[model samples]
Target: MSKIIKKIFISTIMVSTTFSLLMGAESIEISPSIDKKIFHEQYVSVTVKLNNKNISKVLIVTDKNEHYPIELTTQCDNVCSKIIKLRLGENSIRVEGYIGEELAYEVKNELYCASQAFREYKEAPIKYKERFFHTDKNEKLCAECHDMSNNEQKKVAFVDVKDSNCFVCHKAITLDRYAHAPSANWLCTSCHTGEIENKSKNIIEKSKFIAPKQIASACFSCHDKNKQSWDTKKHKHFPVEAGMCTRCHNPHSSDNKMFLRVNSSFLCLECHADKKLSQQIRGNSKCPGEQKDGCTECHNPHASDYRFLLKSPHVDKKIDNNIKGK
Candidate 1:
C-alpha cells in the first residue's frame, strides 16, 4: 500500500511539471493603445506588444471596408512590438498570437475612428445662418449648387459694412433668373449701406441716414429696365420709386404664384383702398366695397406704358379714354 501511494504522488508531480512547461512555451502578452477620439479622414497607429520568443504569426482583425493593416515588426532578444497603420473611419482591431502548433490568446481594441477632412475645408459661398428667422433647422449654403461669383460683391459689401457676419446670415442670391444684367459693378454696397447701425456709444456716429431701400435697390440693381418702364407711367406708387420692392415681392421663392406677398385680389386690395372697386370683381372679391370687373382690368402690378398704371386699353370709353385721359 505504501508503494502504491508513492507511485501515485510521483505521477501527479510529473503531470504538474509538464503543464507548467507547456504554458511557458506558448505564453503571449499584448498591450494596445489608440486615440480616444478620431476625426474623419485621418490616420491612426495601433501599437502591439508580445512576450513570446518565437512568434510564428500575428493577425489584426478590423473592418474589411475601412482599414487595411500595414504590418510593422520590431524584434528584441525575446519580445516583439508591432505598429499597424490604419486608415480613417470607424473600425476595430484585434491582435491574434500564434506559436508553432498552438493558438495562444487574443487581445481586442475597439475604436471609433473618423476623418478630419471637413476641419480643413473652407466655408461655402452661399452659406447662411439665421437664428430667429427660421423655426426649422438652419439652412447651410452648399457650394454644390450655389454660384461663387455672385457672392463676390456680397463679400465685399460685408467687408465695407464691417459686418462680415451678414454674409453668414443671408442666403446667396443667384443671377440665373434675372430678367436683365446687373447694373453698377458690384454695387450691393451702394444700396445696403445703412441697414446695419452702430450701437457703440463710444464711436461717433458717421451719419443718420434712413435705411437704404435694400430690397428695392436689390431688385432695381438687376431690373433697372422694369424700374424705368414703371416710372414713365402715370399714377406710379411712391414705394416703388422709393425702392421698397419687398413690400410686394418676396426675394425668396414663395408658394404664392408670381412671388407676391399674398395671392389674389386681396393682395391688390391690401393697399388699393377704393371700396367701390372691391365689390365688382366676381371671383374671390373679398374687398370691402362694390368691386369693378377686376383689379387687373385697370392697373398693372408691374409696369405699363399708360398712365393710371393701366396695362392695356380700357373697355369703357368713359373710364379709360374720357375721364382718366384728361
Candidate 2:
C-alpha cells in the first residue's frame, strides 16, 4: 500500500509538470484578410482570425501611429475584426499582441485608399461616372473594355486587339523608361486582369477579372525594378523610383508634361518642407513662396544630367547669360 501511494504521487507530479510546460510554451497565430481597396470610403474593413489565447490586448496600429483597439467577434474563439481609417496613399496596418501589459509580437499588413472609382459596370456610382466622362457615355460598347458575350469566356480577359482602347482617351501617355514591358505590346490584360478576383486597386472592375491592385507588384512583374534599401545616387530624392508612380505621374493619362502630377519645382516642395531651401533655390532671401527659378533651375528631378542631379554645370551665372545673348 505504501509503495502504491508513492507511485501515484510521482505520476501526479509528472502530469502537473507536463501541463505547466505545455501552458508556458504558448504560441499565437493570426490569419489576416483585407479587401485591398475600399469604395468611396476612407476606411477599410479587416478580418483577422486569430488562433491565440491569453491575449491581454490586441490593437491595430497604422503607419501614422494611430492605434485602434480590435474586438473579437466571438468570445468562443479569437476571430477579431476592425474598420481602419486610411490616408490617401499607402496605409500600413500592424496588429500588436500584448500579454498582461507586456508587449508580445506584432504582425503587419498594408492597404490603399483612393476616391478614384474603378467599379462602374455592375453598380455605377454617380461620382465614378462623372470622373470617367467618356467611358460613361460609351457604356453601351462593352467590348471597349470588357467582353459581355461568352465567346471569350475569360473571367477578366479584355478584347484582344482593342487593347489600345485606353490610348484613345489617354493620348498623352509619356514614353518614360521606353514604355515598361507590361505597358508595351498592349498585353494590358496580363497586368490588368485579376488572377483570382476581377478587382484590383488600380483597375476598374469589368467582368470577373481585373489587374493587380498593388501597383508595385504589377510593375515589378516585368519591369525588373526592385526596391533597394539604400539610395546610391549623386542626389537621391527618396520618393523617386520608390514605386509611388501616381505620386508624380498619372498612371494612365499624361495630363501634365513629363508625366508629372505638377511641374517638378512645385512637386518637390510638397515634401521638401524646407522653406529656407526653397527661398535659396529661388535666389530669394525675402519671399520663399514666390519662386524666381523653379526646381529645374538647378536640379534635374529625374536624373543627374549634371552632377548632383543639377540641371546645368557649375559656371558663372553672368558668363552663361552673356554667352546665350551673344
Q: Best-fitting candidate, measured by TM-score? A: 1
Q: List the lowest-lDDT window of 10 residues for candidate 2.
A: 125-134
Per-prediction TM-score = 0.34, 0.33
The reply for model 2, stretches above 4 Å from the true place, is 1-187, 190-235, 276-293, 305-308, 312-326
**What tens digits encode model 1's per-residue C-alpha lDDT throughout 267-324?**
5665564743535554573632226445665667666656555666553343555567
Error of 2 at 164 (Å): 7.1
Candidate 1: which stretches are off by over 4 Å? 1-192, 195-211, 280-294, 305-307, 316-326
